[model samples]
Target: MNELQNTLRRLLRVVIGGRWGVFAWSLSGASALAVILWGLKAVAIPLLMIKTASWGIWGLGVIRESKLRTPIRP
Candidate 1:
């Protein structure tokens, strides 16, 4: 089991360190996520809406905090 684990780790290091490996891995993950989201039609819609709203609220909070921290000039 330990030898198998070490071999897997070595393979991963080689794959990730090789040129184009990062892009390939990123693309693979994104494609998998896209397929999963497509399959979850009902859940994805509401989840996306909530995620977008949260981002907007977070942005507004950041803007308000920055304004409050800055001193008003004459």
Candidate 2:
């Protein structure tokens, strides 16, 4: 029972983390601007550009995490 509870907690944390990562990368200020611009038809922004920005955000987060002295654990 304890092991199952631990596994469930880990799974929940991972799911929540993934959602936050997606939101942070894809729904960030720059990404949001790109989306708005695309919506307004002012610029023909490529989907790749948005995806690249999201990857860049993820990369930055990874670098920042590596710089931390202690890794965060749930």
Point to the candidate with the largest lDDT.
2
Task: Estimate the TM-score for candidate 1.
Answer: 0.41
Angstrom error of the Cα, residue 71, model 1: value is 2.7
lDDT of 1 by residue, 1-74 (tens): 99789767655545353333444445445545765877666457655655565445445545554444454789
CA lDDT, every model vs. true structure: 0.54, 0.56
Q: Give the runs in model 1 whose Cα sits over 4 Å from its true position.
A: 1-42
Error of 2 at 62 (Å): 0.9
lDDT of 2 by residue, 1-74 (tens): 99789767655544434444555555556656866766635544665566676666566655554444234689
Clashes of each: 0, 0
Q: Provide the RMSD of all predictions against the true structure, rounded to 1 decimal.
A: 16.9, 6.3
| Candidate 2, residue 26: how far the Cα is off, in Å | 3.8
**All candidates: TM-score:** 0.41, 0.37
